[model samples]
Target: MLKGQPRATSPRPAISPAPGASEVFQLLRDGQPRTRAELAQLTGLARSSVASRVDTLMGLGLVAPYGGAASTGGRPPSLFALNPGARAVVAADIGATHARAILADLSGRELAEERQALTIGDGPDAVLGWLAGTVGTLLARGGLPASELAAIGIGLPGPVEHRTGRPINPPIMPGWDRFDVPARVQESYDVPVLVDNDVNIMALGERSFHWPGTTELMFVKVATGIGAGIISGGSLQRGAQGTAGDLGHVRVAYGGEVVCRCGNTGCLEALAGGPALVAALNERTGGTLTSSQDVIELVRSGDAGAVQVIRQAGRDIGDVLAACVNLINPSVIVIGGSLAQAGEHLLAGIREVVYQRSLPLATEHLRIVPSVAGDRAGVTGAAVLAIDHVLSPESIEAACAALTTG
Candidate 1:
C-alpha cells in the first residue's frame, strides 16, 4: 500500500533544516507559493529557518521573490515562486495517427507546441527523423537554446521496455519494435531522454494534475483503440515487460471472426474501438461515416441508431472494465478519447454494467468521470515525465552546478 501525505505541521517544531529545505522546494513545486512565515507554518519550522532555506534557494537562482503581501499592521511578507526559465524540457506524444511536440518550462507551461498527422507505419527512421525536425523547429521558434533543455520525454502508442527504453512487440505500431527511441532522441539533443507508453503518461498526468490526493486511479482511452493506464498504490503498474495495461487486446468476445491488428480475434478493440464503432454504425445506417467525429455528431443529434450503437459499445467496454475494477479496485475511473464525446449515452451504459457486475466494496465510492485533459493529455503527460525526470535529486544537483558555473 502507498503512504498518504504527512500529517499537518504543528507550530514551532525543532525540525532540521536540510530535509525541510527540500520539502519547502517541493511544496512550492506543488503550487503553494508562500512567504517565509507561511512556509515556516506549513513545515513546522521557525521563521528564521524558513528564511535561511529561502535565501539559499534564491542564491542558487532557483527561486525568486515575486512581490510583497498586503500590510496587516506589520512588515509585508515577500512571496516567492520557482524560476520558470531555470530549465526546460522537450515533450513528445507519438500516437497512431498523429504526433505532437512541445517545449515546456520548469513550471510545465508549454512554450511552443506543434502537431502533424503521422504516417507511423512508414518506419522507425522516418518517424524519428520527423520528430527530431519538429523538436528543432519548436526550440528555434521558442528562442530557447538546446543547452537549456534538461531532458526529453516521449510517449509512444506501444508498450515500452522501460529498462532499455525500447518499444516492444507493439501490435498497432509497425516497425517500432526493438527501436531504441530514447537513445536516438538523446543523440540529437545531448540530454537525458525518457520514454513510456502513451497511456502510462496519461495516467501520470491525471495523478499529477487532475486528482492530486488520490493514489488509485485508472484512465481508459477509447480512441482508435481501447487501452488503460493503471496507477495503484501511488506507483505506475508497469508489469513484467511494461505492458500491463494493454487492455486493447483483451478478448471480450471469443470465437468471433473479426480480426484485430494484433492478429487476434474478437478483442475488445475490435468491438468498441473508434473504427469498430464507426464501421458498425455505417453498416446499420448504410451511410458513410468516415471518423469518430461523425459518430459523435450523430449521437449528439439524438439519432436513435447512433445512440444504440454507442450504448452497446460502451457496455462492451464496460464489461471488460468491470473485470478490471474487480481486480484493481481503483478509486476513480477517467474516460477519455474521441468516443467519450458521446456523453451520457456512453457513460450511462458503462456505469450501469460496472456497478452491476463489480463487487460492492470495490466500487462503492468509485467515481467514473470524463477526462478534463482531453486530447492534450498525452502531450502534457509527456511533459510532466520530462520535468520530473530532470528534477530528480541527482539531475537537479548536476543541472544547478552546470548553470551556476556557466
Candidate 2:
C-alpha cells in the first residue's frame, strides 16, 4: 500500500470559479440542455461572458454538456444540464405525534422515506435524536452518504423564528421554544440545515407543486391543533414574532370556558380541533372516540352524531376563516390535515360560512379546496424547502465541488 501511495500524482490546487458561474448555472438549471446562445439570451449576458461562465461551471462538474442543438445555417452548439445525481438533500417533518424523514434528489423527487410515531412532548432532545436517526436511516437506505447531502430542511409543529431558525413557544411542542433546531440537526449530519413551521412548509410545497403562479394562498391545517400558513404575493407572511398564522388561538366564542393549550378560553382550536370535536361527539352520543381516524370512519358510516359534530366544527372553522378571508383577501384557501379527511362535509360547511359571512368581493373568487397531498403533505413540503435551497445556483456549485473527487 505504501509503494502504491508513493506513485505521485499532480497536486492540483482547487480553484474557485468566477462569480458569474452561479448565474450561468441557474440559467442552465432553468433550461435543461440549453445552447450557449440561448443561455446568453435568457441571462442577458454577452456571448463571451456566457461562454466563460459555462466553462467554469463545466469544470466544477455541477453541469455537463449532453448534446448539441440543431444547426440553423451555422455550426451546431453544445447543450448543458444540471448533474442531477451530483448531490442529494434530506428533509424531515416533525409533527406532534410523528416524524417523517425523506431523502430526495436535486429535483425534489423522493428517493427514500421513513416514518415513525414518536411523542414530541417528551422534550426536544428525544424528538431531535429520533429525527437525526431517521434521517440517517433514510440516507443509508437510499445509498447516499452524509457527505453527499447538500442541505437538510426541517418542518416542526410550531411557529419558527425565520431569522434565528428556532421554535417560539409553540403550544403542542413542549420545551421546544427557543431551541436551535437547525443547528442541532446540522450537528448530527454535518450539513447546512433550514427549519420552518410545518404548515408554512406545507404551503411552500403546495405553491411549488400544485399552484405555481397564483400569489395569495392560505393553507389551514385542522389536526390535533389548528394553524394556517399565509402566503401573500408569493412570499410567506411570518409577521412579527413569526406567529402570523397562529389561528388556533383565535377566539371563536367571546366568553366560553373551553381552555386551549395556549391557556386561552374559547380559542378556535379549543372548539374545532380533533380532540374537541371527538369529546363533543362522545358526550352527545355516549360513545368513546379516540382519534380523528375514528371520527372519519364514523362519519363515513353515516353516523348522524359524528357527521353533525364534524359539520359544526367545520362551521366554526369557516367562521374563523371568514375573518381571515376578509383580512387577507386570499384568492385560494387550502384545507389540510387529518380533519380534512372529512372531505365534503367539512368543506361544504366552510364554503357555506365563508360565502355567508365574508364580503362578497372577498368570497366571490375565493376557492376553498382540500389538500391533495394528504398525510404526505408535511414530508413533501419539507422536501420542497430543501430542494429550493439546494438547487439554487450557489448551492449547486458548492455542493457539486464538495461531493466531487479530484
Candidate 3:
C-alpha cells in the first residue's frame, strides 16, 4: 500500500467524524477491493457511515469502483480502490551538477521526467528558473495540464528547513541560504511544496520503494561529498537543525591536513570524498581526471590505482559509520552515489572496517548493500513525499468538502 503523508504539526489531525472518511479512504488505498461491510467492521463504524464515506470518496474522484467481490450468500458487493490518475505531483531532485524532475500521480507512479546539466552553484534564481522551465517541459511531455497538479516535492543537495521549504546555510549551494524555494517554485502553480535534503529523500525512496517494512536503514552517499540519510523507527530522522546525517563534516581519526568546504581541517569529506580521491589519483598518476564518473569507470575496468584508492576511501567511510552503526543499530546500510558504482571494491573495504570495529550484536544483523534505485531514488522519493502531503487527512478532508460542495 502507498503511504500517506502525515501532518507535520505537533498535534495530530482530528478524526473525520462523518462516516470515518479518512479511515475509509485509507482502507481503499491498500490496493485491495473492500466492501462497505468490511470497512465498517474494520473501522467499528456503521455500514451506512462506510457507504457515505465511499460515496464522498467516489464523488471526489479519489476512489473508483472496481469489479464486485464474491459474497457469502447474497449478491457480491462492489469493490473500490484509489484512483492513481486523479492528481499528479511534481518531483525534483537537484544535485550539485544536474537537475531532474518528474511528473508523478498520487500513487507515486511516474508519468514523465526530464534531466539537464546545471550547477546548483549558479545560485537559486538561475537554478530555480531553469527548474521551472524543466518542470514545464516535463509536464508537456507527459500530456498533463498544470491544473491537475496537487503539489510539488523537491530535494536539494543541502540542509533544508522542511517547515518553510528553505535551505539553511548550505555550504555547496551558494546564495541558497534561507532561500524561499517553495515560494519560487509555487509561483507558477498554486500548490503545496515540500523541500528536504537530497540524501534524506533518497533514503525515503529506498525505504518506500526498494525495501518496504525496513524500519531502520542508513543510506550513505559517497560522491563529491560524503553524507548519510538516516531512517530510525520507520521515519526520516532530521535532527534539531535538520542536519542529522551530515556525515561529511565528521573528523577523521587520522588524516593529513586538508581544508574542507565547511572550513574544517582533516574532515572525512576532505580526506575520503570523491573529489579528494580524484585529486589523489590525478596527482599520483599525473592524469587530469574530473568528476566521480571517471573514478567509477577506472574501478569498473579494474585499474589497480583506482581500485586501491576507492578501497581505502570505503575503509575511511566505514571508520565513521562504525560509530554510527553502534549508535543507530540500523539493519541495512545502503551505499549510493556515483563512486558507489565502483561496486564490490568499495563495499569490501566498508565491510571490513564496519564488521571489524562495530559491536558484535550490531554487525550480526547488519546487511550492507548498494542502492538498487541509483540516481532515480531521490526523484522517486520526492514524488512519494508530494503525494503523501496532498493525501494527508487534513488535505483529504478539505478535498472531500470541495468535491461535495461543487
Candidate 4:
C-alpha cells in the first residue's frame, strides 16, 4: 500500500467515533475488491455504516463497485475498489538550476511531465509565475479539467515552513525569504497548495515510491548544496523548526577559510558542495566547468582531479553522516542529487568513512546506496505530498460530506 504523509504534530492521526469513508477507502487502497461485509468486519463497523461510507466514496468517484466475490450460498456480494482516475494533482520540483512539473492521478501515476532549465535566483515572482503556468499546461496535456485538480504540491530548493508554505531564509534562493509561495500559486489555481524543502520531498518520493518497507531511512542529497532527509519511525523528521536535515551548514575543519551563501564560514557546503568542487577543478585544470553536471561528466570521463575532489566531498558528507548513524541509527542511507551520479568514487568515499567511523552495532545492518528514483524523486514525492493530503481520511470525509450535501 502507498504510504500516507507523515504528521509531525502527532505520531498518528486520531480515530473517529466510527469508521469513516477514509477508513473504508483505505481497505481498498491495495486495489483489492472486497464486499461491504468484509470491510465491516475489518473496521468493526456495522455493515450499514460500511455500505454508507462506500456509497459516499463512490459518489465522490474515489471508489467504484465492480463484479462480485464468490458466495457460499445465495448471491455473491459486490466488491468495491479505489478509483485511480478519480482526481488529479499537479506536482512541481523546483531546484536552483531547473524546474520540473507533473500531472498525476490519485494513484500517483504521472499523466504528463515537463522540465526546463531555470534559476531560483530569478526570484519568487518569476519562478512561481512559471510554475503556475506549468500547472495549467500539465492539466491541459493530461486532459484534466480544473475541477479535477485536488491539490498542488511543490518542492522548493530552500527551507520552507510547511504549515504556511513559505520559504525561510534560504542561502541559494534569493529574494525568497518568508515568501508566501502558496498564495502566489493559489492565485492561478484555487486548489490547496503544499510546499516543502526539495530534499525532504525527495525523501518522501523515494520512500513512498521505492522503499516503502524500510522503517528507518535517510536521503542524503549532494548537489550544488548539501542536505539530508531523515526518516525515523517511518515518518519524516521536520525537527522543532522544520529544518532538522539542514546538513549543509554544519561546521567543518576548514575553519572560516571558506564562506557559504548563507553568510557562514567553514560550512560543509563550502568545503564539498558542487561550486566548491567546480572551483577546485577549475583551479587545477584551468578549465571553466559550470554546474554540478559538469563535475559529474568530468568524473565520468575519468578525470582524476574531479574524481579525487568528489571522493573527498563524499568523505566530508560521510563524516557528518557518521554522527547521524550514532544518533538516528537509520537502517539505510540513500545518496542522491547531481553529485551522487558521479559513479562509485563518491559512494566508495562515503562507505569507507561511514563504516569505518560508525559504531559496529549500527553499521552491522546499515545499507548505504545510491538513489533509485533519480530525477523523478522530487516530482513523485511532491505527488505523494498532494496525494496524502487530498486522500487523507479527514479530507475524504469533508469531500464526501460535501458530495452528500450537494
* Candidate 2 backbone collisions, by pair: none
Cα RMSD of all models vs. native, in order, equals 6.4, 6.2, 5.3, 5.8
Q: Which digits, one per residue and each the tens of the lDDT, describe model 4 over residues 1-406?
A: 3233211121222222233678888788766777899899999998889987777676677777666678889988887777777789999999888999999988898899989899999999999999989988998999988999999999999889998999998877889999999999989989999999999999999998789899899999998889999899998898877898988999876446688877889888898888999998899989999888899998999988888998998888888899999999999999999888997899999999999999999999999999999878999999999988998878987876675455
Off by over 4 Å in 3: 1-19, 401-406
Off by over 4 Å in 1: 1-24, 35-56, 69-79, 253-259, 282-291, 398-406
Model 4 misplaced stretches (Cα beyond 4 Å): 1-19, 253-256
Candidate 1 accuracy as lDDT: 0.81
Give per-residue CA lDDT, model 3, range 1-406, as digits (tens).
Answer: 5343321213223333353478788776656667788888988998888888877776666777666688888888876778777778899999998988999887787888888899999999999898788878878988888888889899999889888888999888879999999889878777998999999999998888898889999999888788899999998899987889988899997976789878879899998898899898999899999978898998888899999999999999999999999999999999998888999999999999999999999999899999999999999889878987888788888887665455
Worst 10 contiguous positions by lDDT, candidate 4: 5-14
**All candidates' lDDT scores?**
0.81, 0.81, 0.86, 0.86
Question: What shift in Å separates residue 64 of candidate 4 from its native position after superposition?
Answer: 0.8
Better of 2 and 4 by TM-score: 4
Best by TM-score: 3
Model 1 deviation from the true structure expressed as Cα RMSD, one decimal place: 6.4
Error of 2 at 283 (Å): 1.9
Candidate No. with top lDDT: 4
Q: Going through the candidates in order, what is the number of backbone clashes in each?
A: 0, 0, 0, 0
lDDT of 2 by residue, 115-232 (tens): 8898889888898888888878888899988888878888998889977789888777889989988778777888778888999998887766788787999999999888998999
Q: Which regions in candidate 2 have their CA more than 4 angstroms from the true location?
A: 1-16, 253-255, 393-406
Native-referenced Cα lDDT, model 2: 0.81
- In the predicted model 3, the residue pairs found to clash are none
* Lowest-sum lDDT 10-residue window in model 2: 1-10
Collision pairs in model 4: none
